[model samples]
Target: MLAFVLLMAVVGIATPQQFWPSLSFVGNSLADIAPFLLLSIAIAAGVKATGADQLIGAAFRANAGKAVMVAALVGALSPFCSCGVVPLIAALLAAGVPLGPVMAFWLASPVIDPEMMLVTAGVLGVEFTVAKTLSAIVIGAVGGYATVAIQKAGGFSDPLRGIEVSTCGTSAITKPAKPHWKFWDDKDRMKDFVGEFRRTGWFLLKWLSIAFLLEGLMTNNLPMDNIGQTLAGLGLWSIPAAAFVGVPAYLNGYAAIPLADTLMQMGLSKGAALSFMVGGGITCIPAMVAVKAMTRLPVFLTYVAIALTGSVAVGLLYALWGGVIG
Candidate 1:
């Protein structure tokens, strides 16, 4: 809020005539996505307040050959954003949860949460929404199972940095308590709900504002349109190129949707757009920082490799399939 206000003031003073248009662009963009935004916030708050989110842990069951597959699905379905999933990842790894399921969750959790999925569908259409969701699942599964294979080959001998890997056994990260559906019945839970609502709402509002503002600027006169066309003109290389760019883009899941829309309008191919969104979501700065902090350099590097490769592969396959056309 303070940041947005400062932005408004700076724009207002620097170019008084441009002030209304900038603010109005952001305002109208917000209005257009208001329903999905509200639903996203409400559901996230509700899950947090009631502790329903903990259910995702069940996907990482011990001795289950299908754990990786289930984990990938659970990760895609869970509402936890990339940054939000980090603490749980840390907890799961420290609790001796195998690297495979954790890797699956880490890669998939951020790509498309409930909020991201809804907004993506709203902004980019059903095809994009489906592509992004499948991207998450496929990446998570491939990364997860691949890690398991490597671990079996004596790789990732020491995955964590400072975190102590406890002996494999039952723990809280593996088994969560039942959710309190009627959270209001408990004052503490009610407080949790309110706090989560405010925090999530504010966090999303700030990012969305920045995203829409950037979109407005690009739509107005940003020279990036030519850049987009050039990238699109690159043919198949455009997919990997977008995936690489997404690694450093650092845009938030929700924030990236409008940007993707704008870029598509500027001539980005559908596959390249998906690659950008998927790759960016996985390697967003916050999540990368968290991964670096919690894991050793090899693990961090491996994580990046998996994300980039998976994103490119997803883009390539989507392109080959004609991106929802065939």
Candidate 2:
């Protein structure tokens, strides 16, 4: 998409008004989202470096079902994005954790986390954030339970049956090892966190830049009236339509929310916009590829089904409630 946008600019196919807004919009969007993105990536790196992943994995090995439920809750509280959470989920699953709860954590982590909620509040207002968070919790719980039920009904067992738990022994011995003053000290930790921040901060900036350029081209070059007219009569179907449109695109909650807000103001239904955002988070190609890499085909399909169903349901529900509220 970024490449296509750039090509149009070079060929003089794009007007000056369109080209300039595209550039400025990209810059502005990146600037707006920089803080949340940095914070989220830093927290993820810090938690991993501090052995939280190992500790969490040990807990999962102790009681698979209960551990997954707890993981879902913890995922909701953590400030990681969909991409960031993938590594943690992969680490847990690789450590002999059950697939059911791992699926739940992956589904819920992006939409329910604190950073996403904060971004939602900033972009769509507090009401939207509350609604999104509540919806994510419900979806995550349902996904978790459904995964367990499917596993039981199918008499399925894990394929990675013999993998040893990575974190099992990390927390078993409670002796606190003194950190080397070179790397584990407070100053070093801060430097490490800042380094992580710069890395993820750059990543966020790159994507937001691309998104803004796309948004600008769409806004300035596309025929607004025609586009609006085509989408106007969608009504309830708009939510699902938006889901289809968003699923293939890769945008986290932070980047998607502001675009969603803009769409809503342009006569797009709130439910549809929200569905697009959620679906984008859950069903992007990168997310699916990551899941497939770690799990079998059945598990991967189940995960995709849960995300699609949950996104569509939430979108429709939001539309119904929003109608009443208005």
Clash pairs of candidate 2? none
lDDT of each candidate versus the true structure? 0.76, 0.64
Instruction: Count clashing pairs, candidate 2.
Output: 0
Model 1 bad stretches (over 4 Å): 1-61, 168-226, 323-326
**Root-mean-square deviation (CA) per prediction:** 6.8, 6.6
How well does each candidate superpose onto the true structure, as a TM-score? 0.67, 0.65
Best by lDDT: 1
The ten-residue window of minimal lDDT in model 2 covers 175-184
lDDT tens readout by residue for model 1, 130-229: 9899999999999999988888899999888766565534433356677889988989988977886676566556666765565465445545556577
TM-score of model 2 (CA atoms) = 0.65
- Indicate the residue-level lDDT of 63 in model 1: 48
Q: How many backbone clashes does candidate 1 have?
A: 0
Clashing pairs in 1: none
